[model samples]
Target: MNITPCNTVSLFLPLLFFLILLLIFFITPFKGNHFSLFVFPLSLSTINDKNITTTQVQVQQPHQPNMRIKKMTRLDRVEEGLAEARASIREAIRSMNYTSEKPEYFIPKGSIYRNPHAFHQSHIEMVKRFKVWVYEEGEKPIVHDGPLNNIYAIEGQFIDEMENSIGNNPFKARHPNEAHVFYLPISVANVVRYVYEPIMSKKDYYRDRLQCLVEDYVGVIAHKYPYWNKTNGADHFLLSCHDWVPSFYECNPQLFMNFTRLLCNANTSEGFQPKRDVSIPEVYLPFGKLGPPNLGQSPMNRTILAFFAGGPHGNIRKLLMDHWKDKDSEIQVHEYLPKGQNYTKVMGLSKFCLCPSGYEVASPRIVESIHAGCVPVIISANYYLPFSDVLNWNQFSLEIPVAKITEIKSILQSVSRNEYLKLHMNVLRVRRHFIINRPTKPFDVMHMILHSLWLRRLNFKLTNSQ
Candidate 1:
């Protein structure tokens, strides 16, 4: 095999070309088989095996929707459940019963005593016999003589009128010689008038006046009856409306001693008791008493009407008149019945009662109305009615905002018949929890005052021991 140099070079060039072509073919992607780029010479067996394995994997794999969509859907369901739960809770609260948290201790029966040393013997006797007192403020003998003589007199005038009208005499029979006279300073009277008259009138005044009155009254009283250094005298002041003290105290820092003013505003009648036998003879008056009426004979009508009286400034009168003039036909309206009548029976016969606040704020009428199983329609703007503490307002009554007076008719109309009946039934169910007469007899203001006095005496003794 003799080979020339040119022939040898030509043979090597052809071999290198063939090797390069083979490498290029292997590296290039196959037209219909993607794996051919990595594995040369595509085989039907290998392709079929790979296809089968891939198909099995695709079929066996767990199916899942878009992650974002699934997450969003789950969040939406959670929100929906939370909303439903909140609504259900609110509804449950609305339907729940209300009860008082304070301890129940009522004054003993037959505890009324006539004080032998009372100054106003007749008045003291009346007070001892009945838990009622009437005061004639002025010195003028207008009650003794004049066409309106009976109009202003506390004894013959007011007492006689009450006896004639209401039938029960609250006064007790006592000897005039045994009466004791306790005079309050004119300054105290002036201070009270200054603080309360303006509010009664609903006229704006300097806020300082309230502070001044509270400080002066407290200082004067404290000066007269120095801190016994022994006991807290809960009955020393014997205020009727205990809730008004806070506003006065806030107005004057000097008026309160060791937070005493705050104690005056407490709702609980903790240590207060009624005076056993007041010596004021002229102040005694009779209180009428009425027996409970039969509900079977006098069934409640479809439309119920109720009234609240005893507003110092006649604000209740105005509100009632306004409501009556506007929607009297749509809703039956009635004046507050006299106290001698059976309140429970009257309320039971009615469908709705008008509950108005005093000149300062809400009064006991709301509780009283609910106790009688009547649906109360609240008409005060600043009323802090303790419905949950004693009875649930939502379940028993319709609270109309004071500003929405004009909408009263529509509100009455909008309530479904079933809903109205349900509310009425709820009132009856909740009334058991708010009966003021139970757990204590003589739960009146007089009893409260006497209890407070006794508590004060006990406190004095405790302090001395300490």
Candidate 2:
């Protein structure tokens, strides 16, 4: 319809206002095209003159609890397998038969009175006095001609001959005169430079060699030594002194074998006929003199910590010094004591005694500790203690790991009084196995070795016959 100029102006203004409101809602600067929206943020970055960044995250897989459990199980199985293998090897060696016949010993010509070395002098004197009687009375003697021949030789000629034969002249004719010649010459310089000095220095080479020799020779095979009492038809080699032979064996395995006869202790026959089976002694312990009666009887503290000190092979002494020095300041640490008073009183007074291996181990201290009704604290990585199957170390004493020496305080603190006392009683019950002076002396380790060797010989003969 036709309208006046004022009416037209009012209608037009309302239409214009409606259009502006629509523009503000749909087409404002804030609501721009896609390119403008992205570029607007860059403008702010330019104004601030600083970089802003966003990082994308990677998702990780959730941990499976079964994986850890499987790893632990596998490790446990491996440990069990190793333990079984060790047990089997020990049983085979223990069960084998041994012979008691003393191996024949021969003294080289001109070796009688010329050698002034202590070992040689002793051997020569013994041979002169006892050799005729030994041959006439019963069996042959195991000749131990020390590292000297006649007066002037620094090194024995027989050893040189034996080593040369083995290394250089393999095809040498075995004549009647040289049949018994098995001399092994080892240089004093070599021993001093490579062995004694390195061991004293505490080098890794020392530990490696020691471990290798023990595993290769002493652990696997038995060696012979001269019997001290030769007058009473006792021409057989003594196995009681195996403890003393480790040092020589570790220094040189080939040389040790050349001089010493490889025989089993258990098989040594008292008579010519091979014994079918022989009983072996279970345990052995050696110690110094007994302490005073008063010290042993008094009950201040029933714990005897037997410290094997005074020499270079004093790992136990070091351990005690490092850990229990301050804690046991009140307790007297007797590094040296008279032999008669050491073992008896220490074992009698103490509820538990520490048994640590020296440079070469299985010392008499362990036996004495066992006999005195004191449990042994075995701090050795390898313990050649016989009849380990019957004895449970956990029941008798506490075993502290060498690596965990720092945790000694916590370990001792964790034990209850009742548990400690129970262990003390358990050790006392097994005291019979280590008493050496008795009729069933534990020092009869030699007898067992001889018997085992004899049995092995018999089995070999029987197998050959078949």
Question: What would the per-residue lDDT of candidate 2 be over residues 395-460, giving only the tens digit for each residue?
Answer: 666776666655554665576778766766665554433332211121122222322322222111
Alpha-carbon shift of residue 209 in model 1 (angstroms):
12
Query: TM-scores across all candidates?
Result: 0.37, 0.37
Give candidate 2 regions above 4 Å deviation. Answer: 1-316, 326-346, 438-462
Cα lDDT for residue 151, candidate 2: 16
lDDT of 1 by residue, 1-466 (tens): 9999999999899899999999999999543201011121111112121321110001111245445544433213423433343233233234431122334242111111211111112112223322222222222222111111211112233223322333333321132112111111122223334434655555444455655644554455445543311122221231223233345545643323222211221322321112111111011112321112324112237344434444333475466556664345445444554558665565566666666544534444554565555677877653433312112357677887766665666776787778767767766554433332212223232233322222222121110110
Q: Note the Cα lDDT for every prediction shown.
A: 0.36, 0.35
Clashes of each: 38, 48
